[model samples]
Target chain A: MDLNLTILGCHSATPRANAFPTSQYLEINNRHFLIDCGEGTQRQMRKYKIGFSKINHIFISHLHGDHFFGLIGLISTFGILNREKPLHIYGPKGIKEVTILQLKLSKSWTKYDIIFHELSSKESEVIFEDEKVTVKTIPLDHRVYTNGFLFTEKPKLKKLHIEKIKQYDEIEKCDYNNLKSGKDFKLSSGEIIPNNQLTLEPDTPKSFAFCSDTSYKPDIVPIIKDVDVLYHEATFLKDREDLCEKTKHSTAEQAASIADQANAGKLIIGHYSSRYKDIAEFKKEAETVFSNVELAEAGKRYSINSYPIEILN
Target chain B: MDLNLTILGCHSATPRANAFPTSQYLEINNRHFLIDCGEGTQRQMRKYKIGFSKINHIFISHLHGDHFFGLIGLISTFGILNREKPLHIYGPKGIKEVTILQLKLSKSWTKYDIIFHELSSKESEVIFEDEKVTVKTIPLDHRVYTNGFLFTEKPKLKKLHIEKIKQYDEIEKCDYNNLKSGKDFKLSSGEIIPNNQLTLEPDTPKSFAFCSDTSYKPDIVPIIKDVDVLYHEATFLKDREDLCEKTKHSTAEQAASIADQANAGKLIIGHYSSRYKDIAEFKKEAETVFSNVELAEAGKRYSINSYPIEILN
Candidate 1:
């Protein structure tokens, strides 16, 4: 299975005319998720032609204004659109209080239920799970209580080998599920037919990790190891590495190092400080540590197998 | 002597890629004030090159999401920019609670002081006053406790009649103040020179009223009478006049009627619904009731004397 990650916004700090704050749209195993909705995210979503109605779940990294300032606005929009489906939001503990308070004040309460899964754990744990995907928190080191998320597609159901199954009339349609589950079928004569011959292996599940506004924490490598795509914040360059410590953010080189150490399939670095005029320099510096690195730009869609970014006009 | 009004955003309901919500940047008497900061206001400000730093005062008309969703984001950006000037915000009663709750959760406290002037009056009252201008509330008929803002420039000091002043060498710089204040100057010879002889007439003070998302309420005519410029919400066309009472929004014709009754110098109608494919139709509809009607567009500026809109490139 393939995973599609669309960058709605990737700029750091405040939102400018040209640069937007952090926000992204992700699709994995037919499930859509919104990550880190900063200010102007709704406009970006509209600009990129993202079917915002598809997103039922949102994963927020932190409570920082740049990361989640757009949450209330989006929620208010949902209310105006008369959305009836429940929206599940996962974020820091204070998210619920702040969001509810704004809705209370605006009196723009939505008919749809807003299910909040407040996060407080400092350790990695499964936060969302369904038949198609499982989402885990990647506890991050930031100024505020923050958590990155690991979205992993669940193993798909094995496909039926029609040719092999058709050869044996004894194997009824009811027995197809057992064979797909890797269970051997027993014929009427007591002879067992191996499930491998009747079923084809499904595609491998894909995983993506989103980590932004955090220090260079190498301990997260194990949890995100072998992820198909890794989105890490590279707020500064190697020349400004000292500022990273004080700001609790990572440099381009530092983000690349984490990608190299984790052995990730591909690294997507963004959340760049406005100080650097050229963002291409970030990729150049990151390449020194990790060869497979992609620069994140707003409206660019990154599909793991397709290395080139697909930009929305 | 002139009022420059820039439409930051002028669409109704939720923000879209082509349309923004209600927000405007007004410059009167050298004072910059932001009115109704809807979502993406900061981005619009940056796009229009509006000096956001000059906005020491913000006036929110209502607590609707489209009216003030961007307040927190703007506040946060000010904090990031390290603004030290005290910011003044005037809005509905619950604004202070909602804004404070968000800041508390994000911990993005500004070093500068935020003075909130919450309003709950049902009648027109002066909410803000300075030596140069005074801001008053225009009680409106909306779904919520909403109040529109009226900004009026204070009377300026009289200009000195250079030829007359030079003729009387006894009138020192000290006597100039008294003459400018419309007081007769008494010379050392015990002769009084009338103030009219020493000073010329000053330009007439201008006033602008911003009324958004209100039903056709003729009662507000007296409050905004003779204003140099008036911005009123025309969320629907005359075709949807029946919806006005229920939605508490005005049609283009209705907005024009109010402006016509108030004897306003000019009328700018906006907050158009997305249902209308062509906003030009709104202008055509409004022209039936009022002659001087300007269609509001984001980034387009209206300076009363200029008559024509100065669109930012």
Candidate 2:
């Protein structure tokens, strides 16, 4: 299974000359999930060729425009393309009202049915679960009601051991089915062989956590502990910690401290404040505490397999 | 008064590589009126550097996604910027549903109130009338219940008689004022002066008609008669007349026929079908009947004050 994330946008509240606002495309087991659709996201997706048809489920982190402005346009595009499949949206409480009003004023009624799961509480809950993955909300502290997402991959079947091939040759025909079902193998001499003797257990499932546009809150460590890849908001540097506190945002150091406390495998930071011209300082500050720190760039994709998170093209 | 139009996007359905769905920016006096905001319109506006904040009212042609997808994102931007002024939107019946749903899901409620004027009937009534201009709906025939818009500038003041300035300074001032107000002037020596003798009549009000994504309907001749500028849909060439009929679209020849019947000053045809790579044929076919025909290109601005719609920088 290929699990990866593509960064569509990474700017904060104000869109800069070259930077875009918050948006990310997460692909896990052939399914695509959109996170935080800021303004102009559809164009960015088009430029990057992220097919809108592939994205059926969308999750918005908060009520900020920089986080979810592009959602309505994306949904409208689906309508124009005559999409018949139902689109599911998970976000804060008022998103449905805003989308309905715009559609009403424009005289556009969607051809497809839209299902919305509005978030009102500040507690962790299992929001979406399927055969491949399960997603849970991580409560966050911000100006508005916001929540992060934790994506955990489901464990797969174990692989057959090659060393025990000859011993089970007599019952190999039936052993193939029995081994896959975790059953014991019976030989022609009436000797029983354990399933563990012929097969090895599958590796542990990998996980990723996304904490978008939230202030520094250590309370989320329990929910995001030991994630393989953790994406956290580093809106400001330590030098601007006062501004971070005033605006209810997280500094680079604060984000790094959270990753360290959670003991996550790797940390990825984004959503820089517009005040900073260069974001090198953010990475430098984050790396001081967390050794495996990666800065997010637009159009970059990170794939998570059995190995470490590898940045793809 | 300055009257001009900027073609932001012009296509029929979903946005393609070179063909963007319907959207046009109209400028009269100093205010900007956005018409038909298709998906990715905000990106187009930003790329072309059209002053977005100048737009106070938006008029959607219909509820089709290609017509008004960009509105929600634009409104969210206004909220993010903390704009205090309210925005007025005029369109068909279903627009409010789309907007309200998005707002409800994102939880980013708008700080500014949005006024929606929904149209369900095909009446040719004045929708908006201000000091400088008046906007009216021109009922149209299409696959959906759609209506075109007519923007007409108020008649300009009479030109000052520069040559007769020094001869009668006392009577000239009053004569010019009376001429501007469409009245006859009297001399101080008890002599009556004819309105035409002192000054010429004011220029007629310049009018622009927007006929988008509709079939060739000659029923609107009276509503758009003698318009100074007419923007009509030319979705296909002459050979694809059958396709135009089936799709409820207009060919280049058909769009020009409407301009000919309306006695319009000029015809600007756009919304080219994606099949045709060379759009010069559209202009060539339109020019066969309408002498003053121009092809509407994206990012090109057409000024109405000038006789021919000059492309602005």
Residue runs of model 1 more than 4 Å from their true location after superposition: A169-175, A186-191, A305-313, B167-174, B184-193, B305-313
Expressed as tens digits, the lDDT of each residue in A117-183 for candidate 2 is 9998778999999887888999988878898999887875677887776655575554576676587
Best model per DockQ: 1
Score candidate 2 by TM-score against the native.
Answer: 0.86
How well is each residue in A236-255 modelled by candidate 1, as lDDT tens digits?
Answer: 99899899999899999999
- Provide the lowest-lDDT 10-residue window in model 1 chain A: A304-313
TM-score of each: 0.95, 0.86
lDDT of each: 0.90, 0.82
lDDT of 2 by residue, B240-280 (tens): 99988887899999999999999999899988877788899
Q: Please name the candidate that would achieve the greatest TM-score relative to the true structure.
A: 1
